[model samples]
Target: MMWPFDRCRINENDLFKHDWRSRSKVQVPQYIFLKWTLAFLVGLLTGLIATFINLVIENIAGYKFLAVFHFIENERYLIGLAYFTGANLILTAFAAVLCVCFAPTAAGPGIPEIKAYLNGIDIPNMFGATTLIVKIFGSIGAVAAGLDLGKEGPLVHIGSCIAALVGQGGPDNYRIKWRCLCYFNNDRDRRDIITCGASSGVCAAFRAPVGGVLFSLEEVATWWRSALLWRTFFSTAVVVVVLRAFIEICNSGKCGLFGTGGLIMFDVSDVIVTYHATDIIPVIIIGILGGFLRSLYNYFLHKVLRLYSLINQKGRMHKLLLSLTVSLFTSVCQYCLPFLAKCQPFDPSTTEACPANGWSGNFKQFNCAKGYYNDLATLLLTSNDDAVRNIFSSNTPKEFQPVSLLIFFALYCILGLFTFSIAVPSGLFLPIILIGSAYGRLLGVFMGSYTNIDHGLYAVLGAASLMAGSMRMTVSLCIIFLELTNNLLLLPITMLVLLITKTVGDSFNPSVYEIILHLKGLPFLDANPEPWMRNLTVGELAESRITSVTLCGVEKVSLIVDVLKNHSQWVPYCR
Candidate 1:
């Protein structure tokens, strides 16, 4: 204070003191712009990677199935069956080995782990590079082996890993020159990035951007802020755009991946269900059935997973042997079922009159003489998505008889449940959707026999109801189905089914993902605690305490108001 510069230093210190109101307002815009830009880049990368993985899985699975089909066409039944069995065994074993030996965290649907991580739980190597690679390849192998799994679940994990890497500046070993992305390296920003990436993954998987945003909000994230909403929406939009462009480019060169137009596309032109006042009875029935099925599925699925865990604890070899045994059993069933069912050749008259369409010609031989799949081998061996599409098609009843549909429903329910928690990377969505479609079509056929209703409509309703019940999701699933079929007219019915399904499901148990989290021992806090907790008294609970505060008189009220005016964190509780 004795020196002249000391007074100037004190003034400078006072001027630079921490003050929220006096901070530069321009930096806020810059920070938001940079953060959003980083999110956009993360979404772009996630979409491109997801598209690549889907294409790869489709091609590999298609080639393997076609190889077996070719052998069957040449009358080499035993060889084809052997090849199919061997292919499934080898692929599943390889995928399992990769997951077990390299990245154990990559196995199963990774949504639970991701959910736990987003809730501030630290999981070792859960989002590492090894997991990303193993998940991508292992999921591809599992799907190619004709296992009842979908790539959608693993894609979320993959997207999170990518975002984590991008946020961390492209891994520790490599250097990333992008300085803008460094802004998101902090913990808070990285969580937002991961959320955006997860949303992007769903967008790529379902080709539904809005549905993706809703899914992340409803199913995945544990903590959400209002500011993150638009960021996730923007990310989903970017992902969808990138994915669509990639699909367009790929379609221009090839005939088209998966037919029916784009990836994950469904036909919705033949829906004829006009909801009447009396139809609520049947809709409610469907919802109840869906809920019961979901509960049953969860119970049995948990038991199977327990058995697998016990077997896994014995030794790694035991797990591999189990994989081989399951593969062999599945192969025998696939081989024998087709011949056991009634055989019908394609009608010569129809074949002669048909135009030379490449797309139709490819799947023409797969159809029987009655314009439907009569052989068991064809029905079981065909792609899951294709089977679901056929179930929802207008000609479903003509193509699949009532008895055959029932048989399929029974067989797939068992296979899908058992195949879900295998050692390899697997998913529940596609299999569950297929099962739900079969259930719906069977009911729809029976109803159409008496009433003037479309079986396709029933199929749609059944699918939505079952999925909603199993996943315990409502709005997102409805939007996803609407986007999948590009049909706005089905929204009301979809909403109704989903609402009923979720209500019934909640009455029984939590969702599949929540169950998995509990089994894994993750510290996930439930938003809605169990009803039994209300019985406990505060005095009986340990570490419970009460804080006392003194009340201010009327004369001190002005001082409190003044404090609230100056302090942003303080508010007038009375108001």
Candidate 2:
């Protein structure tokens, strides 16, 4: 799933230059020290960025929800809906304008660009200072607007930006430099540092350090080495430490919603879960469904993105209008859907159920009686993370009705497809998990008669299957789900589901990220050659292009000048 790499990274003459080799040897010790130092900085910055995004999202989105609920409670339904839709429009417009005006590269999942970069393509302004700024603030606005997307993927790109900025001596504009960091000026060293940064970003996003390392190895980085693996591990470890420290500091409730979940974003540790042999049958069904749905997800998302490309190419105004339209649609759905739910009376026998005030409760009282809660409101009104927690709660089987879940799944699928490919910073990871959990919970209810599996277990495996199917990853995704749930017992099932889902997805279209890469016109060279290429030869390909004049290692300077003057394009050298 990669394009052919044809660029020359190094000059063979450099290996023979005595001064270059001597200077490299002299800088070896400093290189070792500075790289680790860079790793620590990348991790620390990544954690801080993640924490920053979370805080912004919580306060802004929380207050928006609070305001909407306040208006609704006052019996001003029209005003409440207007305010909700208006708030979403304002927030999303701000994010979209940032991308359209300052850094268009900051839009979308950004994992494709990161993948392309790590594969050796030098994407212009990809990790630039402007892109970083736009990404940070833009992501805050879009996510806070309640779009069906996450910030995890954007965080990776942010971390890489920080790494590139720091490694490149803190931006040329600032004119900052360090003697020890000079070694990273080369493409190889900088790429490695960026790889570590990518891993640290994952660690910060999910609070899964080892999973971060595996993510970098499996998805982000194409060139892996022993030292890089160690550096990546160290970087992610530092991220975990930094995130833990932030969580501890925020435990006093200073940081808003982030203070709620410590490290695991979706913690099911308190829940007791166990599955039988027969449970495997339903789990397999979940995997098969996940793959089928994922194929549809990728296919439709690609077409939508293509359509968006046509609209976006029109102008910046068109991009802003598009964003506003989507935000309005989302706000309308979020506000109006809860009315369709049937509110049920609260059950006091089940461990102090429902809430008197604020969000995060399993039960949401939206235009309900004094003692009743609306099931669909709980899934709709609450934040996506909280919605996930409620669904993943093993204690809440009857908490959500089948109709409510089906509604959520269907609505989220539509919203998620539209939400992506917009001119704002967005992520697909958490939204995928959220939708997958909804699908899983629905499946659990469906298979209720045939099996006795806990709905929560089904939700976890469902998330794994969809994630694996869409991302086309197995080992890393399995570990990510394992770490997210903190339930080691679910590993075998998670692995099984991931393997099946990826295999099935491979039989269909490429993973979502690869499709996105293609959309961006980044041709990634696949390791496995296509069957139709069996007769294609290097000689025919070379003859199609302009002839290259290869020079010897000890070629004269005049000869090099002559070749440079003669050739219209690149002149390939010996590998």
Candidate 3:
């Protein structure tokens, strides 16, 4: 198949046509300065974007939870349910409208498109200015509405958008013309900058700068160089600086529960991981089960997204309707399902408060007795970020009942299935982690009699396993998980789980992003080639058509263009 807008290998003539270093107006030193400046700007803008999404989600979700809790506590169940569902509907509908009316490409987890771009395929409107705006606001609405979406994927898109704009000397429509930015207008320079942007994305999202660089190299970018490595590292360093500054600035509880946890989003450093060799039985089980479940998740997600695409192809209104319907369904499940959970009696002797009533806590007092905390309520009542923290919190093995976790995991599994690809900026990262964490907690609770290790460690490993199973990432995921949890002691098991799950998942099907790319029919190429590709030589494709052309001789531009037209773009030098 002919790849649209194909960028074939650069021949010697391209040096005179496009090389930045040889340009009369562009000095190498000045160009380097501009590149670094743009990298800093990309990181700064991406970090600010992440901060904006987090602050908005926390404030809106917190107030909604508090208001619903007040009504529920006062025995106004119908009013509470009405308010909850209405809030979700409105928020989700706003995001749906943004994606449907403003920019349809802003919908869904955008990692697949980003992967395509970094792999040298250019998809239209994938990183446009309008898409950036829609994704920024749409992500807020989707997550704040309590849908099973994450902001990391959209943030990555936003970073790439900013980088693309910078590569073009700002938005073309705005008509900002600067000679310094002209050096990056070429495809090669732009791709490199976008790679830095991709790394900055993960850096800001997880506060893991190193993982960001590794993620760009391992998962996204097909081309790599030592210079690009330094640029990507610099970009992520800037992101951490900006994110850290904001975290410090927002530490006084002014931003409505945004940066309370500091750089480590989930701080389990105090957990004291003490797993015996025999304790690895649970980790192995978790890896196998998490891999199976998440692979199944990818399969179902593909089917659901395909069905949504068909329904959405009819009109934009169908998109809005689907989102609203899912919002209502999620609201019902999140609100009513807690009643089925059996309350666990709170221990007064613990240092932390029982039935805590702040924005987030391990114990939730939802219509339970004064001395007891409802487990399901704790999982469903708070924001996803807080839910992750509470789940991964240390010494909380019995915090949630097995039945409560089972129901919670099952509810979200279905919720995530429908919530993705519904005309909103969604992501799979946190949603997968949440499901896996709960499943891990369930395993920990079930096997409590056999192991002495903290169940929180299992939850962490389970999260890594599910992520690896779905995404098929190795080193980068290992680092990101460690940075997110801040428990380096579990690195060995984390690596083991990731390797086992990734192998298990890959044995069945491609990664989720690959599935998305295949379904969308984007003509992208992966960095890793299959075994058959090794035996086939590039020259064989052009052998039949270019038999008369000389292999090494000067040729006119017209003759070269004519030869290119006859042969496929995938063909290398003709003989």
Candidate 4:
């Protein structure tokens, strides 16, 4: 048998005659330009589609929550209950139906699936057109149903689908003949496109281009080349630009959707925190605690997933009903919490109260007081994003009291764990941040009670530590948090916490993604091997029988070449 590259080898005379640059300069430039242009276009389309999905989810969730708040304000408890229950039930049911009846591959965060795919495992329909549609709408519905899930993970899957579609020369049935760009039909180009799309998804989701590139490098891409790094960076940049444009357009010229000039809006100017040497003690403690908590969380999450699988095996309808039940329970709890808590009369004119329009410049009716939401439910569930921002604010308002912080920490830890891996399109990123920040704030509050420490700083540290522990990501998480908050000053602390968290977490078990991959029985080769196995020699593990190849003479040259090409262990012996 001939080696694959044997026919392509150049002779010495041909090598001397070949021009250094003249022969391929024009063609190379055009090819490079086309490839880059295609990458940029894919990133742009991914961003546009991801942004649209985010907008739809925001609008739907906002409307549903507002409706409940409106009824609460009118003192119509039963009607609000009915609306919340009905909406969540129908939305979750519909989302589950789409996943079950249409695209079963569309369920979950999709990061593990994408990771597996990148590692050369083929999951059917993962990048198909049908999966794309179902993933987009189903994720939107799942998030809008008030489930404690995020759109970031699903966005990754969506971006990959878009990239695959374009890279595969578009669909055959499409009317546009020009849609078929056959430049990226090869395996190498397809993989590169998918990697670019994954990075673009992170970029669009977090508005952190640099972090997105690092995330792609650290988490997704199993194999990386120098050129792919540049391509991923370009893709992330294009995605951020397109996403920001859409956000500004949707917000009617506002700098950012969250009013902070970024995806996660936080006022960094309110409190400037200077870390003292003593602060390291608390930071270290938080890191250790975070690692243990993550280990515990992953264990429980797997057990819960197993339970869910058992229930799912009963029937598709049973799975759908379970989803609806979870959504209904969550909605009812969120809605009823405001009424259950004591309402303190809050004067909007007061210094400490929330603004007249409330946290996000809307949803003032949910405020138990005129402008104050002293209620635990309001603090925890009214709007998760806003609540997180408040916790991170230097001069926190009345809503983010120390007690409220503690309650939120406990509540979200439970809720986030259970809520994840449900029959919904939930991403662990946001929920992990939410829970981590709450604990960090709680620690900050405690420190503030004793010394003049900044709670916001601790909140940031806690968030970084917990996320690192849960995800088992070190550099990527650090960069992501830094980019997400634009808190460059916190880099030292963030890096330390992540390092510690990862060290502690890895000592116990693998990351959540790795755990899920193992649970699914995907053939993932973990880079980290067991320490005990290091002492074992290859001979100890090998079979007793051995085969050897010998080249008797010049007549066996082709045989030697074939053996060399086919078997890495073959030794060509000449006698």
The 0-to-1 C-alpha lDDT of every candidate, in the order given, reads: 0.72, 0.82, 0.82, 0.72
The TM-scores of all predictions, comma-separated, are 0.83, 0.93, 0.92, 0.83
The segments of candidate 4 whose C-alpha lies over 4 angstroms from its true place after superposition are 1-27, 172-183, 251-271, 344-367, 527-575
RMSD per candidate (Å) reads 10.0, 2.7, 3.3, 6.2
**Clash tally for model 2:** 7
Say what the RMSD of model 3 is.
3.3
Cα shift from native, residue 106, model 1 (Å): 0.5
Which pairs of residues collide in model 2?
1-526, 2-524, 2-525, 2-526, 3-523, 3-524, 3-525
Candidate 1 lDDT tens digits, 324-380: 666667667755566656644443443222211122121223323434334344457
**Candidate 3: segments with Cα more than 4 A from true spot:** 1-3, 6-11, 14-26, 257-259, 262-265, 533-573
Write candidate 3's Cα lDDT for 15-102 as tens digits.
Answer: 5466644556548778888888988888888888877778888889888888998897888999999999999999999999999998
Q: Please give me the total number of clashing residue pairs in predicted model 3.
A: 0
Q: Which structure among the candidates has the greatest TM-score?
A: 2
Pairs in clash, predicted candidate 1: 338-376, 338-377, 345-369, 346-369
